[model samples]
Structures are given as structure tokens and as C-alpha cells.
Target chain A: MNIKPLGDRVVIKKIEVEEKTKGGIVLPNSAKEQPQMAEVLAVGPAIANDEKRKDEIKVGDKVIFSKYAGTEVKLDGEEYTILKLNDILAVVE
Target chain B: MNIKPLGDRVVIKKIEVEEKTKGGIVLPNSAKEQPQMAEVLAVGPAIANDEKRKDEIKVGDKVIFSKYAGTEVKLDGEEYTILKLNDILAVVE
Candidate 1:
């Protein structure tokens, strides 16, 4: 990505919601809520004086973020969300 | 006044919008947008490693905060807004 996130911000790509159930039933798009799960594409530098928060999120990590917490951006015809570190609720284990 | 803000949060009471213009003409409520100015009532402890941010805001200071940036709260029948430091736009002179 050409864009670099600055100051405790993260760039993420939303993971597409699964369209099929395990039982082979297809689900309609309207039936699924917007997915909160995202993959970390790039992470900004840590804020000064916050050592513990540094390295907690790394590229390729799957994370769950709060709904309505990020700014959406379009780059190279692809969509991404930029979020503050505080917006990330948890790392998907 | 009894509720304490936590984790870099600040409690503020919105300053009422002026109802009269300098020319002494009365203005209707609809003529005014929600005021962003407020009086700082209380402040929470600073986050670790951010000493510069500490003491930047204090009780009794007049401040301007970002619109839609705080949580509305009620205490003892009075309304207040709890906002993070990041939501505070500037300290009014």
C-alpha cells in the first residue's frame, strides 16, 4: 500500500462474511450484518509513552473492532478502514 | 459533580447558547446550533507515558470540544458530557 498510517492508526481490510452455512445452505446478504472482523494491513507507530500498546497489533493479525469506529478510505479501487488503536476491541485467536 | 470521569475522560457542562444578540434581539432555539463550548467540571487521570497531556485540562476551564464526541450523562438531574481528551478541540481563552 502506498499510504502510510500515522500515529497509532491502523489500516485494515474487512473480511468478507461467509455466504454459505456449514450445512450447505446459502445465506442472503441482507441476513448478515456488516462484518466487524478485519485483517490488519499496516500499523502506525506507537504513541509516545505507551510502550505496552506497541507491537500488540501487527500486520496480518485478525482483529475485531467496534462498530462505527473507523474512517473508511478508498485506495487503488480497494476499500480500507483506518482506526485508532483504541477502536480495536480484540485480536481474533 | 459526584460522578468521576475515568481514563483521560473529562466531565463538562455545556454552556447555554446565548439567546440574545449584541443588538438585543432575541433568537429562537432553532436559530442556534447545539453549543460546543463547555466548562470543565472534572478530569480523569492521564494515561501512562503521556505526561504532556496531563494537566493540559483542568476543572473550571472553558473549552471547546468536538461535536458528537462525548457521551451524554445525567447526574442528580443535571446533564453533562464525558469526553476523552482527544475530543477536546481547544481551551477557550
Candidate 2:
């Protein structure tokens, strides 16, 4: 699906968490904190500046995002969200 | 206290949640979701771009952030974190 964000928003796909615990025990979904990780799929036009410069984030970068930043939806068998670029917590190197 | 962030990082003071619920029920620390909100205290020099542009966030902007984004520290009786600007979830209006 071609997902695009408006303004400084970004579209992200949540990265699923592993089902196993550190000690090798299988964990139920309810036992884990929702993983705050994502894969960037699209970014909006950068916030404009007085100098008419535009900065943009690239697609396909792995990012760490807040657990609650955007409205969530499932499209084409995948989950995605439209969030502000500033809502992204950090870009994972 | 004076705090400065390195690179795209920002220094934020965690906003304290109300100890009581809107229904007038007192809530213990353990019973509430950790408030993922902060007040921006300082911002780092903006990341450099090929265009030599630096976009900086201003001080005193109340922001909503993730529950876990940066290393926590206490400076002069206040708790703060040095988090990358990308870690900020959204600039709360």
C-alpha cells in the first residue's frame, strides 16, 4: 500500500516483539511491554523554515518510536500508523 | 540548573502526574501508567545537513515523549534526560 503522511507526519510499521523471554520461557502477549520499535515506510514534507529549506527523513530506516504516537491501522495485512516525524523517539542505527 | 544536549539530543524535565484521579480517587505511584510527558528544558545544536541548515527546537516547549528514550539523571534536585530530538514523540500544543 502506498501510505503517505500529511505535514511532518510519518508512516511506520510496528516491529513485532519476540515471544520468548530472556530465560528461554515462552511469553504470552499480555506479559510483554509493547515494543516501541518501528520501520519507517514514508515521511511527510519536512517542517518548513523561514529560509525555504526542507529536511526529510528517508524511507526504510529503522526507528524507535513512542508506544503511543499515532493512530494505528492495518492495511494490506500489515499494521501502520501516521505519526509526526517528531513523534519518532530515535532512529536506530 | 543549566542543561545542554549533545547533537540532536534534548534535555527534558519529566512532568509530574496528578496524584489523584479526576474522580477524586488518590492513586498510588504503582497504579498509574508512567506519564510519558515532559517539558523541554534545552535543545542541542541541530544536526548538520549538506545545506548547512540547523533547525533547533526552542526551550520551554511542553512535549509528549516515550516512557523510555534516554538515560535518566538528576541535576540540582530535578530529574532530566538527554534524549535525541528524534525521540520526542510530539510537540504538545
Candidate 3:
């Protein structure tokens, strides 16, 4: 099932990093490194201010989020995170 | 100078993890682990959601944050990240 967050929360599908090094060395799960990127699946409506402002991100945007930004959730056999709009560092176009 | 975020940004002081192991083993910087903790330093005003609601965190609180949630900015003699409030997972009282 798809889990969507309410309010300013966002749902992001994590991009898995390669388990092998450039030199063809294999890495264990414990040794796996965190990636600096992710794909945006959904964003919550802007946290209501005086008015609802448009959020800077949209669906399918590839983004760079802080290394520590969203709550983790497992969905549809994959892992995803629900982050607040502020947790997003930069939208990678 | 402190780099306070202008909007829903929060300033966090990274908690340096121990470079040693249970057996007194030494870990290199490259082999260093990311800590699941940080201390809150400052928080920006709520992004005007109709009215400013009180934030869930405050200064000096130790917190658990998403492993990928903020922008890294080096201020003064230390490194800190400015995350959106949503990036914060749970505060350690």
C-alpha cells in the first residue's frame, strides 16, 4: 500500500546504492553507505500559513535531502521516507 | 557566525561519534559511523501555517533525526546542519 503523509510531510522513494565498489569489491549491508539522493514520490500540501503557498517540490523530482531528513516506512516491498518539506536540501531538477 | 535558517530551518550541532570500538579498536575517519543523535541549537519561526504553531522541539534537546534530512553548513569551528522541522524524528527528553 502507498503511504502518504498528512500536512507538510512528504513521501520519498529511496534510491538504492550499488553494493559493489567501483573496483568491483563487494560491500556488506552493514558496510553499505548512505546515498545523497532520492526520488520524490509525493509531497504534503504546504503547511498552512496565512494562505496555502505552493511547495517547491513536485512528484518525480530527484532530490538531495539531508543525510538525516525523513521518517522511514516500508511500503509495497520497498523502503520510503516521509519528510517535511524543510528536510529536503535541494531539488535536483 | 551562526547560520540560522531564515524559514522553517533548524540548526543542529552534530554529535561526534566515538572513533573507537568495544574492544578499544580504532576506526578511521572514513570508517567512522554516523550518529543517530544531535543537540538542537536553534529553530526558525514556523512557516506561517495560518498562524505560528509551537514547534515540537526546542534548544538543547537531544534528538533523533532522519539519516538524510538537512543541508550541511560549517559555522565557526564546527559543522552543523540546518534541517526542516519535519526532518526531526523524535526528541530525547
Candidate 3 chain A lowest-lDDT run of ten: A47-56
Give the worst 10-residue stretch by lDDT in candidate 1 chain A: A47-56
Instruction: Encode model 1's per-residue lDDT on B1-29: one tens digit a residue.
Output: 26545446677899987688888998886
Minimal lDDT window, size 10, model 2 chain B: B47-56
**Candidate 3 lDDT by residue in tens digits, A1-93:** 666578887788777766688889988766885765688887675543323334455688776676766788776678888888767755543
Position A36, candidate 2: lDDT: 68
Which TM-score value belongs to model 3? 0.47
Q: Give the lDDT of residue A9 in candidate 3.
A: 75
Which candidate comes out best when scored by lDDT? Answer: 1
Q: Per model, how many backbone clashes are there?
A: 0, 3, 16
Q: How does chain A of candidate 1 score by TM-score against the true chain A?
A: 0.80
| Tens-digit lDDT string for candidate 3 (B7-86) | 56677887877678888998876687677699987766544332544456678989999886777753334777778787
lDDT of each residue in B1-93, candidate 2, tens digit only: 355343466778888787888899988877988778888876654544323424435688889887787766543456667687777878777
Query: Candidate 2 residues A3-88, lDDT tens each?
Result: 76777778888877676777999888778876666788877765433132233345887765656778998888877888876666
TM-score of every candidate relative to the true structure: 0.46, 0.50, 0.47
* Docking quality category of candidate 2 according to DockQ thresholds: incorrect
At residue A48, give the lDDT of candidate 2. 39
